[model samples]
Target: MTCSEPARTTTGRLPGGLVTTTRRIRRTLAAGPRVVIAAVVKALGYRLVRVQYHGTLGEADGAVPRGTTVFDDEVPAVANLDPALLGALREAAKDAANDGVEFFVNSGWRSPEYQNRLRREAVSRYGSEKEAARWVATPGTSPHVSGNAVDIGPSEAKAWLSEHGARYGLCQIYRNEPWHYELRPEAVEHGCPPMYPDPSHDPRMRQ
Candidate 1:
């Protein structure tokens, strides 16, 4: 449907009764063969690397710095989160804890310097700097840069979250990275793609 067309529910209701859906059929046409090729590659498991908080990379490591406090720590910077989203997450965590699954925020809000250092380290180890880009996003492009994203719980909690996180406005963005979740509704609606780097030719790449 065209963007100007008013959305309607199947039951012929308007307002909150209807869900707004956006289609990118025309945008895909303009995106050309590359988008299709990328989709195919993604389907074939030529997927991006999953980064996690406190994950080790070689001896020096790269992910989030060790010993950095989680978002739920004392005097939390909960202001970094959207209020509604934060409340939802807190309720979700409490619910999980009630179910005997402990949930905790592991990381949030990365500085540009930290992201840059990670990008540089990944480049050094992987050889192809472009390859590094696939895993460690450039500073401005990172969701962590926005301070609205968080890595939650631990490795063991992955399965539990996969089964139940959606009830609380959280979803694992990367299939392989269980800890990461974002407050963006678009992420939930679109089915969270792994936080891969923007394509090399993407205009944002130059930044």
Candidate 2:
């Protein structure tokens, strides 16, 4: 029997080594969509360590300072999101507050680098990229990186948003991730579009 080398050893760093790393990424992706995400995170150990110590890669990477809220306009994670998305979240939060439900920003805008780290970590925790897709997404396709999505928290807040969000253009994007939401202005009149089962089911992720 033969053993394949660990994926990490096969990957290389940038400035001169991306060629090898990128080829590995291509080969892993070509194998199947499930393994594709593992390749993207193979060489991210150092950056992931930096993220752990600093809690972020800094404002340039759309890192939300700890304890960020929907109203924290000064935080990059809140400020960097699409203005319309921010507006909708703020509006929904205000109403939710009236119901004794305060919205906490678990995640908002993210730099592509941060998104990649999350995918890498998810893959590690879940034991495979295929399962990770149920939670995290690749940087290129993550709504958070695009500033179009937010992950709110607190069971009460999620419940409040689930019931009242559409009136303000905030709608949960995935059935499995009830805390995740995106702005859809038309929802105010027509209601939100159907939810995707998970990130993998969203057609946008393929791109």
Candidate 3:
């Protein structure tokens, strides 16, 4: 439905949908038609946020931040993180290593092609698009493809980071993803923001 569609809308609700749009997000979405409607709402909104590629994924050559660098003999390979975010992650990882926990970079700086592949793989594994979207993000708006996110791994590393990451301005953005961390500089001063309950409700997914 277009924004002008008439079915009556309260603040935050989609113009013609019954699934209430919300600011407080959950990390996992239940599989159902209402959730499917929420996915469509987010999908449409994402298209509008892409000022450059017009919602095309994996073609963001212009999205690369200036001065971005690749890994240099690090304990684990992680490339294409935002320059400042990489610095913060290294510092945080160094500290975590002191506690006998090393953060392994499972993914970093994914291309649109790569991200889309992940989405496809997820859809196959989960058996449906709506269920897959609750986990893997569509490429165009994924922070990872834009070099803004890194997934850390190893249960021990995730455990250590969960407890101490905020001190270094690192934060886990999703409630269900314990190993995903992003550089949230404000966390150093105010601490990490609360995790989104799930991607379906996360306002960021729409952007």
lDDT-best of 1 and 2? 2
What are the runs in model 1 whose C-alpha is more than 4 Å off? 1-79, 186-207
Tens-digit lDDT track of model 2 for 7-104: 34434345557776667777776687535544455543321221133355776687666778989988888988999999888888887788888888
User: Candidate 1 clashing pairs?
Assistant: none
Error of 1 at 165 (Å): 1.2
Model 2 residue runs over 4 Å out of place are 1-60
Counted clashes in each candidate structure = 0, 0, 6
Task: State TM-scores per candidate.
Answer: 0.53, 0.70, 0.63
What Cα-based lDDT does every candidate model obtain? 0.56, 0.82, 0.69
Candidate with maximal lDDT: 2
The CA lDDT at 88 in model 3 is: 85
What is candidate 1's lDDT per residue for 50-134, written digit by digit as tens? Answer: 3233533331222444433333433233345456667767777666777777655565656666667777988998897777765
